[model samples]
Target: MKPSTHLVLLLANAASGMAVHDDCKLRFLELKAKRTHRFIVFKIEEKQKQVVVEKVGEPAQSYEDFTACLPDNECRYAVYDFDFVTAENCQKSRIFFIAWSPDTARVRSKMIYASTKERFKRELDGIQVELQATDPTEMGLDVIKSRAN
Candidate 1:
């Protein structure tokens, strides 16, 4: 007489993960929000080749007021959303655009207002940008050929 031993093994699907559906394929790099922090998002769609920018959480009110207060040709810092005269105040001022990285595709676009002149000077030295928001609820941005009068 001979005894036979049999075992059954089970395997899970390789694609399934938390919150991931079997039907939906894995996304390359998707933007995910963590905590709600006062930030801005700037987005440039490659497919459309269009630029859109907006602020999230809290509006840069201080920065807005500061820029608005500048007299004609008095804004020494570079302008992104608003158009200002650049003459005597700014000896060398230029707009800088930074491309999005693969991991940072979903980051919020924002610029913090420097409380002190030294902080403002530091900001001028390094111009950092975030992913522009596209949602209407966020912030509405119109691409104007010229700065709004």
Candidate 2:
């Protein structure tokens, strides 16, 4: 019998040699359990071969501020605590995992990010939505709103 898809993915991730730093999980727990952060940005440390926390948004930071933290020519992984109101006017919050691979980023960086995204995201336990953006416009407020709804 062929190996299961999950096993294949696990083997692929192991071969990639990119691991998520422990703090990546700790910070995500802070955000998910205590609302300590509005967003968390992550980057792959090429030298260390690990995905590590690059920056974090304060609880009061706006989505625009979160967007501003992302570099125009780099790839990053981010988790945002998004708040929205439903048609019934009830308040709700959702965690979003975003893969930001800008079109202008280096090809190698993009490939590494793409290959490692699922592995990194799996470490964060409470993500409610997932988005892959190749440009800022693709992840704009309107797009987020639509996804949240």
Best by TM-score: 2
Model 1, 2-31: lDDT tens per residue?
Answer: 222111111111111112121111110111
Q: TM-score of each candidate?
A: 0.18, 0.90
Off by over 4 Å in 2: 1-15
lDDT of each: 0.24, 0.91
Candidate 1 Cα misplacement greater than 4 A, ranges = 1-38, 59-100, 103-149
Report the C-alpha lDDT of model 2 over 1-149, residue by residue, as the tens digit.
36676655654565378988999999999999999999999999988989999999999999999999999999999999999999999999989999999999986688778888877888899899999999999999999999997
Error of 1 at 7 (Å): 52
Error of 2 at 6 (Å): 24
